[model samples]
Target chain A: MSESNTPRLPLLRFVYDGLRQMVRGRVVYWSWIGLLLAGILVGGWAYIQQLQHGLVVTNLTNQVSWGFYIANFTFLVGVAAAAVMIAIPAYIFHRQDIKNIVLMGDTMAIAAVTMAILFVVADLGRPDRIWHMIPYIGNFNFPASLLAWDVVVLNGYLLLNLGISFYIIGCHYRGCEPKLKLYFPFVVLAIFWAIGIHTVTAFLFSANVGRGFWHHAILAPRFIASAFCSGPALMILGLQIIRRVSNYPIHQSVIDHLAIIMTVALQITLFFVVAELFTEFYNETEAVMSAHYLFVGLNGHDQLVPWIWTGLGMLAIATFIGTVHPLRRNLLLLNVAAVLTVIGVWIEKGMGFIIPGFVPTPIGEIYEYMPNLNEVLISLGIWSIGLLLFTLMAKAAIPIECGALRAPGIPAGKLICRPEQQAPEYRKEPVNGESES
Target chain B: MTRYAMVIDTRLCIGCGDCVVACKNENRVPAGLNRDWVVERTSGAWPRLETEFRSERCNHCDHATCVQACPTGASHHWGDTNVVLVNPDQCTGCKACIAACPYDARYITPEGYIDKCTFCHHRVEQGLDPACVATCPTRCMHFGRLDDPRSRVAQLLRERNGETLKPETGNLPNVYYLK
Candidate 1:
């Protein structure tokens, strides 16, 4: 096979091989893929119903215009931002174990951002008219609109990750060392951009002087802290799955690093929650209407009471597990913590944050909302699409990173010019890697 | 300089809801939807009930949050009329305007564009009062240029202790309620 160190990668061949690699897995992979497709099909049907009937098919009323889809969009943005957890340690801190799997983080970000955008599309009353906000093509209200700013930052972050993933994997496929000079500047921009994406999302809510619940300063920092925990928690579970199913080497040190970051992030997030709660409750002013509704009840409407408590309970338990050194080190316990963090953040940061702001709405009307069947099905469908994208991406990438897939002439398990014995991840992989087999 | 404003004398309003009905007819607001509504707020204990019936609609604020929050320039000030409007052709129905309005003033119509009280800008172009103002049974509603101190709305605000809903929001609402 002809593997070349020439700077220009063979784009067509790389794509062809990547496509071929995705379909090479056994029954479990096929089953997983089949299940995702099934979800998409049902979701697509539900989406059609939503389109024909307009948004009325969903439980979303004018009072609660944004619900399930926006909530998922919010959660996914946090997941996408969490890629920084891996990138910072990999590139900036120069940890070889983290560096080995950092591309996986990029993969995660791409899938997540893609899903976030899709969720936004799903939420739109007239999604087809989205081009109206397109910067050059439409009358995009640039600096004035926080939603406009979100459109810019989110699309920018997605492009940044796409470029980073392409360049990193292309270098590996071409059997050459990824020169820091070529990739480092973009890597640095990406880290800040990751933080920016989540920050902008938080600001989108906080800048709304109309919604007393979301109009606070702490929401932005709180979004970041919560994002760190949820993002890494997702990565930990995904990495373990990748290690089990493929030849992708996921080291204990990598898991430990992420768990440690998540633990610290969890604590910081909890502190922010406490700080915000104190501000809302200290004097019990008219402004506490939404928070009061969320925590206790407002005029006999206590629907959201169960949800917020469950989220906090999970977050608290996860934090406790992560704090104790022995428990954090235990893989089973760590996975449990990760699961708890994901569900907790989904509830806490998703509906717990968005819905309450609109609950005891600005005019002091009490309108409660629950996602209907169409909304739930559509959400499940989009999530499946995201997981499907992530699966295929990881499938194609794991082999190249492990030196199992390269330019046609390069032998399996041989990296021609990468740095020598970089770490355990760079150790000689078995010939005719199962992924290549 | 033609800053259109509404002055509702709540002291005279009898909560008949004729203003709300007139807006629905004028705007062709979707079924079971409203551009304006009567809010009957009762304060104090049962022994002493103090009630005020205020007809609420879009403020079309001088500092309109909907215009600022709209990613597309669909929500805009209508020329020299100083009235706010949503251009359906430009609206993507992102609903940022809904969340940005403290009055809960905007809603998405079945056509999938945001619909709200436009101050009957269409009728206003003919130099006529908004449907709600003209149709009020109690003659409690007045509409005119806030910039013109001689206008009825401006005169009423100058004479009465008028209050705007959620003035604390800094929205600079053009709608004032005279208690």
Candidate 2:
């Protein structure tokens, strides 16, 4: 630290510093916002059209009612689960460097969940009637309804993350430490809740006995493993962008640490896929027939073949590129590999994951499902919104991270406090000696 | 006070899908959607194949998983009867029941409401049998009160070892199929 007698500036100068710093980062911030706005406008237009015309806008027929909406929901579950990868280390293992950065994951969780809810809304033909979901209004089926449980769990998880983010940010703004004593238990619950959202989603599909492909027993664990890869890859990509634009620099060690998690997650996902394939092909039972047919192409027309092959190809590329001696060592390549792994898993866990279960039909007929243009646009729009939300949050957060908005000693302007520090000794006093210190 | 159920004799079914078409027309079911369907499993190879058709719908299982899987209680068995119905208003279009149902009887409709054969509950309310039973050209489907010993369906069950789909799931489906 350089020794200087630079007197502390007044509140107005502090406010000016915040605005100037944001203006300097305007290129990066505005670009993200601009692209996001374009996507939302396009997506909103398509969604409005869909609402008027109904689900006919999508290629989904009765044979495939799920299509992209369910797939996106599945993908976002992985995103939500990935929040734990960061949380486990920082809160559970008490990793100090990750402590300050944990809030990023909290915000990401909120964004992921927002997208998931939006996808559900878009998937509905009559989103206006969503109020029927209100308990007792239409009828809450309770323990029998996993969807009801999903609604509860998802909303609960969202509120939990939002609460934590607000508490932490409020503390930071006020130059006080957040009261960890109160929020810690909830944080611990959020970790398990993190795992809960994905597991429940897997069970949502796995519970279908008639759909042989989805009935497999290992779906829950498979979901967790896949989420680990996709979530960390996405986070790594986000961090790389933050490092580039913001004055703050995250330790290369943090990136390397997350890379280890990506490696393990990818390996496990690959193993599960192989194991599932072996069970289907080797067993040769009528039950496994549809999965094999959809995955490897059964009766001359392999509609999903190219996409599935590409997913596997990308998986191989991700593993190889991510493992290359200098590439993993290099932040740029590591970021590239992370991007591949995320996309690869998205395809694998999205379509390759959901469609096969309905193939070969329950009685025995192969029906194909393809997403119509509107469906694609609406999905893209929701994703863009998530990115936009993350960007805005980071715009506010990155300044604090860069030390540009921080108070001289700690954070300033807010009086939030940890319980132990809430004692009279630590409370802020009047500046001109009108109040006791 | 009405209990709705169906009896299908696979031995007589010709895989014509007449019941499927009839139900759709009666229900105003959208095109490409089937509230009731016949799954034909063809055995043997090519020209020598022998096909077996099983007409399936919501069995209105005594322990219906669809009801259990519905997060919003949109799917439920009618009082003391073998009929499952969905309140469209209550459904969130989540499709959880579609996945939970082992029989593939549940379908997600264009309106995002879950749809399935309700044993023609609307018809039953009007003192009639399900349209599928009423319209079957082959007289392959029988509709009656299973609790009434005098009913043909009950007599048929006593005479034959009728089976329900995925009985092991313990859903206690009211619909019975005769081999």
Candidate 3:
């Protein structure tokens, strides 16, 4: 065995080593992967059916043109953007607790963005024609179309997170400290980019003067606040799961700190919700009918009332649990709060956000919308694909971060030069690494 | 440049829905969707009730939000005529334009591209009136070049008080309604 102090392998070899470790997991892991695969198969079948018979398969109509797919896309964008919550405190503020787990947030972001893109694909009536939105090769209406901005920001954010996370994990694998100069600027840009993804998504809705419920200036800020709440909450839950399933160290203090951030964000989100509600209810206008449909019943259509109230109720409970320090410290309660916060925000930001705008549509017509079986299955399939990607990424990354695996010739706990800065001799070492063992 | 516009005299409309049927036949709009429809707005107390019937379709605004929201330039103003039209070949069917439209006029066709009232542009290009205007039994629907002083639509606008729908939207719709 080559026991040289410096070990280097080709880029593809490193990826191969990482992927080899990914497929080798416990029985529970395999089962989980199997479940995700089943979901993907089912969803793919549903999508094929939809492709055969246009958007008529979904519950969407001319009146309710956008439905569950777009709602999920909007929410997932917030989830993708929420990675900045960890990035900001870890890199910018020099917080040590989140430093180790920040990569997980990036992993979550990659998965979330993948899902967001898939949801957009699922929602399209002619998804095959999607290349038309591509810049240059296709006629991209930049600057003017917020959808175009969304596409650019979403893809850019995905690449940024993927690059940074992979680079960090690769450095860890190579037993080297990542160059702060290279990553710091990207981290700062990611923070702003994260904010941009959700804000641009909000702009996508708000720019439409037609949808009165979404036209308010407060929508973007509200989206950010809610994302901050839900994103970190999901991360905490994920970290807790990782800690339980594996030997990954998760600090109680970090969970509590994240809970605090979520609490504040949840409170801010509620404030915005109340502000929007007051604005809608105080003066009864023609535009207020959609809001009426959301909060109350509009012209006998009361489908979304139960869901919105449930979301509000869950948000209140989550906020209360998160506020009490003792409750926040209790992992069980904290996780419950996190779960509730996620569900609440999912409902509030997803269906509650998109549907109300189209309820009493622009021409003052009420056409109720509900996702059909095909739509739900297709959505589930996309979510499964996201989860599968996340699991694979986490499987590969966590082991590297935990020092269970390392690059060729790089021993655990030993510091070496960054990959690019290594001597030519380092690149000539054996391709096989500890991951093979 | 000819700025083609439509002036619908709601006062003269009987709400018989001939225009709706004519538009569907002319545009070949799919079943369960519409390019045009009649809306009956009823107000006041039980004994003192008043109902106004107005036929509504694509406004084809000068500042068309659909045109702006379309990522692929699929929804564009038809040349200098300023009538909003969707190029199905270019449409990705993302429905961004549908969401952007204030009038709820656009719909995804069964073929998976957006479809809306095109002011019967095909007929207009051939120097014939729109199918809706031609088929209106009451002669309430009038179409002509808004920039032409001699056009009947311009003359009607000068004689009668005409208002566009949802003027607060600032879309500056080319379609006007005479009440």
Candidate 4:
């Protein structure tokens, strides 16, 4: 401690300082922020129009009640769950290589969850009545409803990640070690919670026995496998970007580890896809209609045929690149594989996953669904908000993690101590001898 | 113990869609959406074709998935009447019920809550038949209490060997089709 003591600023000041750092960035950062803001504005305008006109403004009809919004919501749930990949290895297994980059996973989770919730709100015919789902204030059919389970798990996962990240970053800012006791239990819980979130979401779809496409026993496991692939692929890409833009010491080994995880997960996801295909195609049943629409054109409606095939192609290429030792080692190829994996999973999990269930509607009516302009704009806008949030969170947390910024008590320009490096300092404090004396 | 059920004789149905129009007017359903619809199921090819006209609406099942799936008690059975009804005030319009209904009978109303065939519970309360049952030109639609053996619905079910749509789903639909 310094001889001349300076009173610490209130907790609010730390938050203000963090937010201020987000705005004072370079031209590229400003441009990115501007772009996201534009999306938000455009989306907000469309949402206002929807509010005045109701869900009728969108292309959604009674036949296909859930469209682009729910699809994105479902995909983002998996993305949120993907945080568990890093959290498990880093926190549970104590892998040092993964520890530094786990913050990025947590940050991604926060952004994805925010986007997921926004997508749900966007899809609601009466978004204003969302309070009806809130506990006590509204009737939450918890035990009986999978959607209710989803609401709990998603929010729980979000809070877990947010708390863990904030505590670690707060410790970094104050030039002290985060108490393991405080965050370790939460991290462990979060690992299970992340899995729960995705499982609950999968059950939300699968439990709908009405929708033959989603009513599969393998759905939850398939969700986890796909989440692992897409989440880590996104993390790998994000780590590469961070490594390029900042002084953060994102190790190459971390990227390699993530690639290996993605590769195995992608393989398992593909296996599940094939298994699902076999089950559906083995017999000519009414249940096969949705899968038929996905793989081939159902009647005259073939809008999604191209998209699903493209996703499959991308998945194949990504898996090939990810598996080969030399290709995996090559940074460019690895990045390409990561991008492919993300896009493939996005298509496979998003529209590709949601649309099939609606085609050949229960009454045997075939009404094709495509997102109208308003739906697209609103979706883009929500995505922009998520990106903006992630950008700001990353901007605030990264500097603290790198020791470029410190809390009020720490001297300016002093290097922040890493977790491993802080061990010796703790060891030097001879607690037992001092107590004995 | 009053189990309200409906029996629709597909053989007597003329594909006139009178029931659909009557139900729409009675419910004041939004334009471009339907509370009841007549589906034409056709099989075979060329000169030996067969077509069947079936009237479809909310099944008001013994185990209604919509009621089960509703996060709020918005979609529920109306006591002994056993007709599935939506409490507009409680509905959040989350559309979980719409997705859960295998029959695709539910639709989001202009008011933002789900709207479906309520078995004309208002008319039933007045000791009158549903608008569809009353206006059916062929008198193919029959609505009565299934618990009473003397009720027309029960007698028809016993005589005609009536079958519920998608009975394999185990929803135990109250609406039966007299083949």
Best-matching candidate per TM-score? 1
Q: Candidates' TM-scores?
A: 0.94, 0.87, 0.94, 0.93
Least accurate stretch of 10 residues (summed lDDT) in model 1 chain B?
B75-84
Worst 10 residues of 4 chain A by lDDT: A419-428
Question: What docking grade does candidate 2 earn?
Answer: medium
> Where in model 1 is the C-alpha error above 4 Å?
A1-9, A411-437, B45-47
**Judged by DockQ, which candidate is best?**
3
Model 1 chain A, poorest ten-residue lDDT window? A428-437
- For candidate 4, what is the recovered fraction of reference interface contacts? 0.68
Clashing pairs counted in every model: 3, 10, 0, 0
Superposition error at A166 for model 2 (Å): 1.1
Candidate number achieving the greatest lDDT relative to the actual structure: 1
Report the C-alpha lDDT of model 4 over B6-37, residue by residue, as the tens digit: 99999889899998899889888778888888
The deviation in Å at residue B135 for candidate 1 is: 0.9
Cα lDDT of model 4 by residue, A35-147, tens digit: 99999999999999998988989998888888899989988999888866576777667777688788888899999998999998888888788888888889778778777
Tens digits of per-residue lDDT for model 3 on A1-437? Answer: 34474445557777898889778877888999999999999999999999999898899987888999998998899999986656677776687768877888899999999999999988888888899889998889998999999999999999999999989988877777789999988988998999999999999999998888888899899999999988999988887777666656456556666888899998998899988888889988778888899989887899999999999999999999988867876668888999999999999999998998898888777899989999999999999999999989988877777776787666665322221121332213322231211
Q: Candidate 1's error at A316, in angstroms?
A: 0.7
Across A1-437, the per-residue lDDT of candidate 1 in tens digits comes to 23354324568789989999888877878999999999999999999998898898999889988898899999999999987556886766677778878899999999999999999889888888999889999999999999999999999999999998889888888777788898889988989899899999999999888898999888889999999999999999998777666646666677878999999999999999999899889988888999988999889999889999999999999999999987987779999999999999999999888898898878878899989988999999999999999999888887788787887765565642221122344223332232211
Q: Name the lDDT value of residue A300 in candidate 3.
A: 88
